[model samples]
Target: MSSSDHPNISGSSQPLLHQKGKEIQEFGTVNQVPLGLSYDARLYACQRLNRVLADTRMLYSLYKKHHWLMRGATFYQLHLLLDKHADEQLALVDVLAERVQALGGVAVGDPRHVAELTSIPRPPDGVEEVPAMLSRLLSAHEAILIDARDAAARVAALGDDGTNDLLVSQVVRTGETQVWFLAEHLVDTPLVRL
Candidate 1:
């Protein structure tokens, strides 16, 4: 058919794949985008966020263990630091889980799911040294921060702004803050503490 003879597509000629955000309703009223993200995008964010939560939980336990059991000349400071990190990681886990649920996917619960899904490498059992424990946690947190930023950017590109914003805010605020705290132990250049 000739271009002019072909029927003009109505409504959003923007194509479903590229279209996003709220639009006008049939009655000419604005409506929210109704959590109706593409399946692949939703699943991708779900798995990514779920993995992060699992890894953070593991790191939380590690920090708590170190906080209570660590011994050194700087024991008081290190103990407080570890405890503080545990709380931060715990809050991050909650945030991630909520995002997963918001995407309409079942979060992988249970320890088995975490063991399977977590991308962060596990520290060896019975690591009793302070420096050793801190090193492992710092490494894990770094990886998580990287992944969170990447995943958030990807989701935003796919037009899932809610998940994207959730991850972006966490990545910028939480991960950066944790990095400052962890860096102090290793930097040794009179850096100001968090």
Candidate 2:
């Protein structure tokens, strides 16, 4: 067949791969936006949201790990609960990332970048006892909740209502509910009275 008959198969063109270039937008800088928010407000909100986004990613990781590692008497229930919670956290990650972008800042995309930004402590590589694992999740939730509270207040003060609403209405509320669920699993209660 003539090369012109199958242009796609011609040896003249190849796919672009392994391309690298300088970053167009630097991290920690916000572009001017016309969302009725001042540049400073947008900048501050993006900074706070990115920090929470990083921690939420870590929390999501913890939930997945614990969900898979759930064992002992309440394994089935705890496993299902952790997986559900993980899914919720995943949803929050997307929402949080988009919020940062809406503020005209770069959302931290790389897992390595998230690791560098997250304040949540790294857990052991091995599986922990069931209660210990549950406790670890609660601790992660606590960290996120604390940050959410502070960030929400600061963003509100900065006149970034959208960011404030997201931190309070979504981040804080979700973390608090998840914490309640995880904490209940650690209580010394039997499935039924002996």
Which candidate should be chosen as best, given TM-score against the real structure? 2
lDDT of 1 at 170: 67
For model 2 the TM-score comes to 0.91
Candidate 2: residue pairs that collide: none
Off by over 4 Å in 1: 1-33, 189-194
Q: Which stretches of candidate 2 lie over 4 Å from their true place?
A: 1-14, 191-194
In candidate 2, where is summed lDDT lowest over 10 consecutive residues?
7-16
Q: If candidate 1 were superposed on the true structure by all CA atoms, what would the RMSD be?
A: 16.6
Question: What's the lDDT for residue 77 in model 1?
Answer: 89
What C-alpha lDDT, on a 0 to 100 scale, does residue 7 get in candidate 1?
A: 40
lDDT of 1 by residue, 1-194 (tens): 54444345454344446556873322111223257777777777777777677777777777787888878777998888888878877887787777777676656567777887777776666655776777777787787778878878888888889878877786557767877887777666654777
**TM-score, every prediction:** 0.74, 0.91
Model 1: how far is 53 from its true place, Å?
1.7
Candidate 2 lDDT, tens digit per residue, 58-137? 99999999998888978999899999999999999999999999889999999999999999999999999998998889
